[model samples]
Target chain A: MQYAIIGAGPAGVIAAETLRKTDPQGSIVLIGGEPEPPYSRMAIPYLLIERIPETGTYLRHSPDHFQKQGIEIRQDRVTAMDTPNRRLTLSSGDGLQYDRLLIATGSRPIKLPVPGIDLPGVHNCWTLEDARHILRLAQPGAKVVLIGAGFIGCIILEALAERGVDLSVVEMGDRMVPRMMNQTAGNLIKRWCEAKGIQVHTATRVKGIESRSGPGFLKRVTGVLGLDAESGSANALGVELDNGHRLQADLVISATGVQPNSEFLKGSSVELEQGILVDNRLRTNIPEIFAAGDVAQGRDFSTGGHQVHAIQPTASDHGRVAALNMAGTDTLFQGSFNMNVLDTLGLISSSFGLWMGVEGGDSVEICSPEKYRYLNLEFQEDVMVGATSLGLTQHVGVLRGLIQGRVKLGQWKDRLKRDPSRLMEAYLAQNAVL
Target chain B: MQRSLHIDPEKCTGCLQCEMACSLENEKVFNIAKSRIKVFTFHEEGRFVPYTCTQCDEAWCMHACPVEAIQLNKLTGAKVVNESVCVGCKVCTIACPFGTVNYNEDSGKVIKCDLCGGDPECAKACPTSAIAYIDANWTGLDRMRSWAARTDTSARA
Candidate 1:
């Protein structure tokens, strides 16, 4: 049997390794688009902070690890896939046949259509190439304007801050990480960043980017006179804001969001919603084809409805389950729980499952914004459906345990309603009873 | 036969020798904070329970690792972290349900119990046989035998 996996990210790599272990005789081909080795985009932040070298971003360190396992690694990308013919065409003009295919093609950053976005100094911190460009311009004291304040953006914020760049963050939403965090929690993060000497602008939008016209005569004259250090270097970008303010930026990082890289599946007859729709088995509507990672919109643990969880944990879990089924193990995928744990300038915040609280559901909150400590619980009857916490890192897994285990709180629910900090006690009590 | 570290929480006296041994063995430090095995104190209940990586058959940390840094040692059945390749993403720390896998901020990598490559120091240092290195396949055999002894009428007399 021949297994072809596209997009050599975590999901695709894991699936290839799993297939090798499950069916030793099967031929596997893992395809990646980048020229470099299969690496994790999640490690880009660490790379930016100089925590690790380029080799550290690799999904596998050994140069011949895949070759040793007899799994062929191809650096070409899929141009088009003919699902009916069980074949795929590569960008390098190569064609391949396969018995099973996995679309782990992940997602790409959304490029805003504004003018001057394609300029050299502007980049999306999505790939290794992008990180190299960022490092060249994001030097200490460099004026950097970050486009979004979401999860990915916040991570980039930490790296940029660590690099000692004069950073300014602009968010379109009312608060930071608007999708992953609530208002009070998000604003607290903004305040924390502000305290750490980073300028944060919320409820704002970047109108457009305009390149500073080639140094004017006076500026050129100043450069010749050795008065203006940055003059005659024509790469400075002017970021126009909706609020009628313009900020001069040496580097502009666009981290607005990402969309599934499923454009190639336009007429493939494989289902596509927000992403490629897959069942609990990670199988697409097409029988021989499957999807995983950010490209797969599988089941949500709390809602039980199909949703795209583009997190690392979900990607790895989907890969293993999909590979088992691909290898004829007949495994069922447990739905992914929606969770986000973030650290912004030393303040840790996390949210799990239906943290926003369902309609008509009972909710409790303890917000000590002054101390940057917050805990909120959402409940449907007696069971805790979701939880969010800031600065409460001890035994945080108990929140996950209670939600994932679907443990009934019984009378303990009332005690928790009075004090949500008793999560450890509640978890231990439930474990003891069980 | 593969061996596994088994912990009987009841036998624990909360002495924390296992923690000291684990930290010293893996991190070359006496600092309990650096220990792979942690002893949680239940001050109100006057009990302590020691916990670490179970080295599960399908270890979540191994699969969750984007890089193949966590690999299984065939002889010991221990999943060990190759720190050189680790990018310190901390994804495994969240993926682990038992929370045994943890991030080491100093090294910018993760650390977990590797059973000391089959010669577990925690089991050796436990003054009270609270932790034992036993056969992996028969982890429950001792408990089953004890129940059998309880039901034996000949011994009861």
Candidate 2:
């Protein structure tokens, strides 16, 4: 059998290796869009911190590793897939036919829709190329303005601050990491960054990014959209906020978030809602085609519905399952766990399961922001549905265990509500199956 | 036939003697933080899983490196990172599913277990037989050779 895997990210690479192991004689091709060797986007921060060189961002280190494995690694993008004919059209004007296909295209950074966003200095910290550009401009003492204070933004903010740049963060949300943390936890993080000497603006929306050419193209674009555009231009690259404030920026970075790289799946028969929908077997609607990693909307542990769990571990798990099924060894993905453990400027914060409490569920918050410690737990009936903790490392794996195991809290729920610190006892009482 | 390290998590006591031995032998220090092998504690489940680089036949870390810094030591079948060539990008750290590859802040390059050039320190230091370096093969030399058997390509005549 011939196998063709797309994206060459974590999922695609793992699938290729698994297929090679499961079926030693199968012909395999790993296709990637980037020109460089398959590298990890998560490691781009280390590159920015000067901890690693461009070569360090590569996912593998050995030369001729792919050739040794008998797998062909092609650095080409797939322009279209001809599913009926079991073929694909590549950007390099080549075609590949495969008995089995895996889509692990991952995600691309969402470009901020602002006028001066197209400016040379404006960049999104997503790819290795972006990191290289950021390093060129994010010099120590450079005036940097970063848009969005989400998880990705916060991580970039940490890297930029370490470079000794004068950084100002603008977030429309009232606090930082709004999606991952609750208001109190978010406020604590914002205060921590403020204490570290970062100028932060919350509850403020960027109205426009104006080039010296009189508000750039927003004037014309907004005029067509029938929205009021800013009247005048400024000497430097100025960011106009809805709160009637302006900030001068030497470099602008957008780390808002990412969208699935499933655009090519469009016009194809693959069912997609924000991302390609895949069954527990990681199979798309078509039998020969499968999707995994950030590009797949698989089963969610909390919602039970399909949604993209765009993290590294989920991507790896998805790849293994997809490859097993593709290699004719049937395997089913249990479900994608929603988990995020972020290390932001030495503060380790993690969220697991449905961190936002489900309706009709009891929740508890243990806050000691003074000590940079906090824990929030959400319980539905007799089990822990979700948890969010900052500055506590030991509870992270345990919290995931309880939630994933679906352990019944029994009477410990009342004790937890009274004192959330009893989590260790509660965890031991009911879930200590060891 | 190739020797490999076989880990039994059930026998792991989490005493971290293996970690200390690993650090002392390779890094010349006793710091646990600097240790290559890590013992992950599952308090709720009351289990300790001591994890390290599995020395995969087709190692992900070795393949992922762009600089070709991680090279296969043919004798030991271990992928060793050349610090001189490594740019310290930490991409290998991300690529390894077991999280064995680590970045050294002082050196600005990543590090992992190299099996102590065939005589591993972790296996010797283990109080329990949790980590055993034995004559067990991972996908053996034979299985790897079988891949060659199917190929139209061959060794130069």
Candidate 3:
């Protein structure tokens, strides 16, 4: 059978490999817009900071491995899909027919519509090329302006700050990582960043940018316009406000977030709501077509609703599910847990499952500001649903399993609220004996 | 001789063990997002680079601190942030060429690498030996040795 896969990312690469393992005789053509081989996008920041060497981020399998598995990888972009003709047109003007096709276009960074955003130093960290460009501009003492106080933005702050760069963060929301973290956790992080000398501005909007002309080009960021919350007025570069003032930066990075890269399928038959809608079996509306990764909006097992999970683990699992169905095997993707692990200046925070739900849920918190330890857990109907931990991550594995396995809390529910560590030990001991 | 943390980026896998260890030691949480040491990745280049405060001999953070909240520990050669004395003016944060020193709003103080009071947890928890505590004087010994090995004249002879 002829199999054509768009995107050579983790999802597409894994799907091709799985298909080769299941059906060795099948003809597979893997197409990707990126010129290089498949690499981990999550590790891009480390590469910029010189924490890990370039070759360390390469995928487990070499290029020869794919060749040995009878797979052909074409480093090109997929321009259009002719479902009726069962063929795909490439940007190189090449057409290939296939019995089955996988749409794993993945995601692109969400760009803001503000003026001066298209300037030279503005960047969005998504692709490898984007990382390289950012690295080139990130010199020691370079002033940086980061928009959006989300996970990516915070992580970048930690990395760039170490490199001796002048950095400032602007968040439109009242709190950092407003979507993923609660106000309490956000406050803690805000405190931590401030303690480290990173200036964080919350509840501020960037109206526009001012460019200064140099000998042959624009020298630097002349000014930035934003409204201060306290004064409720426009603030220019070094804008004086009731609270403080705003400053200018050399480079501006927008970690605003990302959306599914489904633009290629705009006129296609594939249905999309944020991403390509996929069934439990990972099949798209088109019978022969399938979607996975950030591009595929699958069911959230915990919520039982369709959502785009942009986590690495989910994208890999989506690939496996799509592969199983493509190989004529019946298998279902159970969905993903909303798990996030963040590493900031000197804090480690991780949360899983339904972190925020309806009120009246049993909540347990252990905080020791003197020791800088904080932990919170939320339970609904006597079951572990959401949990957050700082400093203590050894408990994450057990807690994650308990939530994922849907184990009965029973008598342990009360014990957990009182003494979680002891309860976790008891649960682990019981599991070991069983 | 005092020792400093040596980093070998090639050995790093971006597991964030150093970040976790740092945060846990300083903040008592396993959140990498709060760790002092950060790992940056250049995806297209297939690299992972871990960066942190180099603990300069001059120590700009310590000197720039208006209230003298930043102090250098003689034994550990680390600049420690004193929360009690700090007023959160953020003068040191701007003064430090490397943006290592930062302000924490929760405690109204500044935070930086304290070397974990001599036993740095980041170096200890590094799984791949990417970050290691070694003699400060011989920080360039490893690089020199590698280059010296490449200069062998046996091939020409």
Candidate 4:
């Protein structure tokens, strides 16, 4: 049997590895669109902070790891796919046939619809190549203006701060990580960033990006005229905000958000909603084809409906389950929850499940902004449906366990409402009772 | 036969011998903070429950690892973190429901119970048999035996 997996990200790599383990004799081809080795986008921030080299971003350490396992790794893009014939057309004009196909194409960063968004100094910190470009431009004392304060934006904010760049963050939302954290928690993170010498502009939008001609531009002119001068010297880019304020920056990194890379499936009979729709088994509308990772809107733990969980852990789980069914093992994928644990400039925050608190659901919150600590629990009857906490890293996984396990808190619900910090005790009590 | 680490919390005395032994075995240190097995002190209940990685069949940390840094020890059925490969993303630390996977600031890699490569030092150093390396299939055998003995009416005055 031939298994062809698209997009060599975390989901694609894990799917390929699981398939090899499940069916040793199967022919596997893992196709990655990028030219570099299959690497984790999660490691790009570490790469920016100089914690690891470019090669360290690779998913596997050994260069011959895939070859040793008899899994073919192809660096090519899938331009079109023929689901009826189980065939794929590559960007390089090559045809490939497969008994089973897995789409783990993942997502791409969304560039804002602003003027000068594609200038030389503006970039997205999504790929290894983007990281390389960021490294060259994000020099010390370089004025960097980052657009968006979402999960991806805040992560890039931390890395840019570590590089000693004069950083200013602009978020269209009212606070940082608006999607993950509630208002109280998000504003606290903003204050924490401000305390660390980084400027944060919440409730703001980038109107346009204007290129500034200054001393740096003269250097570029000199280099272009065959003078023995350095080329591509950084110049300040004016980031005009909706607030009628402009900030001069050497580099502007856009981390607004990402959308599933399901564009290639435009006319393919395979289903596509916000992402490719799949069942609990991760099988798409077509039995022979499957989808996983950010590209697969499989299941949501909180709502019991299909939702795209664009997190790494979900992608990992989706990959393993999809590979099992693809290998004819008949595995069912229990849904993935919306969970995020973020450490921004030394402050830790996390949210799990329906952190926003469903309507008609009981909620409890304890906010100590002075201590930079907060905890909010959303309860549907006696069960903890979701929770959000800031600066409480110890044993925080109990929140996830309670929600994911759907444990009935019983009397512990009242106890938690009284004292939200009793999560560890409540978790222990529930497990002991079970 | 695959063996697993079995914990009988009732037998624990909170001596932290397992913690010290674990730290020494894996980190070459005597610091309990470096130990994979943690002894939580529930002061109100007057209990000390020692816990670590369960080496679960569908290990969350193992599957959740983005870089495949966490691998299964085929000999021991233990999920071991490959430090050279781990980028210290801390995703695994949160992915684990039991919170057994912990991040080490000193090494910048997450640490967890590797069962000491099958010969677990924590089980050996446990003074009260609170931690033991037993048959994976019969980890509940001891509890079952105790319950069976409780129902014994064969000889009672």
Candidate 5:
């Protein structure tokens, strides 16, 4: 049998590798839009900030290594797919037939719909190219304005601040990382950013960007207009107010968020709601064609509803399920656990599982501003459902397992809040089969 | 003998250890989004470049800073941002050509690399030695050595 994987990202690569292992005689074609080999997307921020070297980002396998495994990697974008014909047309105008197809196109950054957004200084942090451009624009003492207070935005903020770049973050939400963390956790991060001299403007909406234009060149960001929260009115550039104000910046980066890159399948028969819809078996409505990674929408582990797009681990898991079924092996995609580990400014914050909407759930909150530590745990019916920790994230693995496994609290219920390690040990001992 | 952190982008793997170390040392968080050193990746080119304040002898951020919030740390040769006196006017942010300086909305003050009081945590934390503290005058020594090695006939001939 032959397998064709569209995308050389984590999901596609894993799927190809898994298929190769399952069927050594099978032919595999790995198509990727990125010119380089598959690498970690999560590591892009660190690469931009000079934490790790470029060589370290490359996958363990080289192009030749894939060839040895009988996996053909074609570096080109798939413009269209004829699912009925069992063939694909690439941007390079090549056609290939496949017994089975896996679509793992991943995601593209969401662009802001503001005027002058197409200006030279505006950038979206999605690909390595975006990182390069953003870095090139960053100089000593340059004014930088970041739109979006999400993970990417916050990561860029931390990196730039360390480089001596004056940075400003404009978040539409009332708190930083609202989607990932609750107000309480958000407040802790906000305080940390403030302490580091990084200005964070929340609950403010950006109206448009003003660029300095005139001559042949020298186009730089003059100011940003937005609504101030306190005054509830339009604010001018450089005018400081509670809600909004104009910020003059040399470069403007939009780390807002990303949407699944499923635009190519617009005319196709694949079901899509933000992303390609897949069943628990990781198969799309169309038989033979499978979708995974950011492009594939699957059931949420916590909510058990159709949710589009998860992080890297989820994408990898999706790839495994898709590959197993493709290789004639029966496998079901369980689901994904929503987790976030963010270290913003001086605050290390991590959250796992469902920490929201437990009306009468048993809860424990620990806050120590002087020590810069905060911990919050929520339990439902004597079972660990979700947890949040700031500054000290040593017990993340223990918490993650408890939430993922839905382990019984039983006698260790009281010890859960006070000593996470001890409670984890006792729980493991009880669960360990003699 | 003032030294600045030198970055070799080719060595960067994008682990973000530098960002974590810098934030922990300065802001006490693992937030890479607010770090002083920034990394840029050219995905198509398969290149990762870490960028930060070069701490030029004639620093524009220091001169353009209206309230003098940006000052040159004579000991470390870093253009440091003083949070206490900073008015958050962002004049220095616009003046710099490289767009390194930024305004912090949370603190209402501008932030920049202060060289971690001379022992730069970013350089130390870089696992791959992508970032290093080298002699300011001999920053190009690595390139020189590479060229010199290429001239040797032992391997080529």
Candidate 6:
């Protein structure tokens, strides 16, 4: 049996490892689009912050980790797949046959439809190569303007701040990390970034990027002539916003968001929603092929339907579950929990399950915007279905415990409705685990 | 069901024996920093809260772990971290809203209460019976029994 996995991100690497463990000599071939080793995108921020070297981003530290496992690590992208024949056509114009194929191709950062979005000095902090380019331009005292204040953008914003760059963030959303966090939490995070010397503009949009001439034009002339342009072009870029505000920037980083990298799977027999649609077992409509990672829209626990959870943890879990089923172990995926934990700057916050609260569901919230502390709990019937908290880490897992266990809060449910801080006591008293 | 650790904060004496025993049992050292179970001291309130990993069936730590470094031991039902496999990204630390999963910089791995591979040393070392390893199914029985006893007013009469 031959197993071919696409995209050497966390999902691809883990799926390869799991397949090898299940079927040791199955002729496993791991394919990566990038030239580098299978590295975690989560480590890119650490790379930018100088926490680790380029090699540290490699998924397996040992020089021959994959080779030792007899897994062929191919640094080539999959242009398309032929499901009926169970073969993948590579970008290098080669075809490889496999009994099973796992599409672990993750997503790519979304570049906005604005002018000068692709100009030099503008980069997306998604890949290692992007990190290398960012490291060169994000010098200290360099004016950096970041687009989008979402999760990816905020994390990159933190790293840029650490590099001592004069940073300004523009978010089209009303607050930061809009999708992951609610309004209260989002606005609080924006304020937290502002406190950290980051100028955050909420509910803002970039109209266009204008390349300014003057010293910058002369510098670019010298730069194109193979001479050091130096700081001349550094101040040559200007960002115009819909709010009639113009800001000068040396570098612009786009962190708007990402879309599933399932474009190559287009026109294939495999199904595609916002992502590649997979059943609970991570199997596509064609049993020979499967998809995981951000590309697979699996089960969403909160809604009991399919949704694309593009988080890292989901990618890793999907890889393992998909590999197991692919190996004929007949394992079933238990669906994904809506778990999101964010550490904006230094403040830690998390939201689990149906965080936005269910319709006709009872809810409770305690907000102290002054202290940057908030707790919002959502309950359906007697069960706590979701919770969101900020500035409190101690005993927060109890919220998840209650939800996962479906622990009947019993009489303590009323107590929680009164003072939600007593969740720990309720968890202990109910002491339920499912 | 496997046995689970039952903690009673009222019975705790603010002792550090659990920490010492935990560190010594797992790491073979006397360093409290290496201990998985932590006791938070609320000096102003004169209360000490001892906390450890609950090892939930679908643990967030296990789910959030990108490397599958955190696994569930079917026998003990404890979520154990495979140190060798862990990249020490500390995502589990943040994923754990309770803050039980902590990072050890020396090993570049996140350490959590593994219940000492089934036989927990903290329960054995507790002098005041603050921490007890009991049947997992019946940890809640005592609370339920107490509530039931309250419903029986004949005993009070």
User: DockQ scores for all the models shown?
Assistant: 0.18, 0.09, 0.02, 0.23, 0.01, 0.14
How large is the interface RMSD of each prediction? Answer: 11.8, 12.2, 23.0, 11.9, 23.6, 12.4
Local distance difference test values of all predictions, in order: 0.82, 0.77, 0.69, 0.84, 0.69, 0.79
Q: lDDT per residue, candidate 3, A1-434, as tens digits? A: 99888988778877998899888889999998987777667666666777655544454324487788888989998888888889888999999999999998888888877766675567787777877767866678877778888878876777788777878888877887777677777777787888888888888767654443421222223222242221121121232222345456556787888899999888988898989999887899988999988899998867889999886656766776798789888776776556666667657666667876537778787876555567777788766777766654333434554565454677667767776654344333223211
TM-score per model over all chains:
0.88, 0.75, 0.69, 0.91, 0.68, 0.84
Tens digit of per-residue lDDT, candidate 2, span A287-377? 9999999999998877789999898767877887899899998876778777775656667677778888999998999999898899999
Error of 1 at A218 (Å): 15
Candidate 6 lDDT over residue span A1-434, tens digit each: 88999988888887888898999769899988888878877777768878678876776677899889999988888887777788888989989999999998899999799998876667888999999988988899999999998878877776788899999999999988888788888889888889888998889999988777744665669688776543446666889999889989988899999999988877888899999999988899988888998989998766779999898777877888888888877776766666666656667677778888899999999999889999999999999999888876555565655775577888878888888887766665565311
Q: Pick the candidate with the highest DockQ.
A: 4
Docking class of 5: incorrect
Q: What is the TM-score of chain A alone in each candidate?
A: 0.94, 0.92, 0.90, 0.96, 0.90, 0.95
Query: Whole-model lDDT for model 5 versus the true structure?
Result: 0.69
- Candidate 5 residue-wise lDDT at A434: 5
C-alpha lDDT of residue A116 in model 4: 83
| Model no. 4, DockQ | 0.23
Q: State, as a TM-score between 0 and 1, how close model 4 is to the true structure.
A: 0.91
Candidates, ranked, TM-score: 4, 1, 6, 2, 3, 5
Give the number of the best model, judged by lDDT.
4
Query: Higher-DockQ candidate among 1 and 6?
Result: 1
Q: What is the lDDT of residue A350 in candidate 6?
A: 79
Model 6, runs deviating above 4 Å: A214-220, A224-232, A432-434, B1-51, B54-63, B67-90, B94-99, B102-111, B114-125, B129-157
Model 1, docking class = incorrect
lDDT score for residue A401 of model 3: 48
Indicate whether candidate 1 or candidate 2 has the larger lDDT. 1
Number of the candidate with higher lDDT, 1 or 4 = 4
Better of 1 and 3 by TM-score: 1
> Backbone clash tally for model 2?
14
DockQ of 2: 0.09
Q: What's the ranking of the predictions by DockQ, best on top? A: 4, 1, 6, 2, 3, 5
Please give the distance, in angstroms, between residue B123's alpha carbon in candidate 2 and its true position after superposition: 13
Q: What is the lDDT of residue B75 in candidate 3?
A: 94
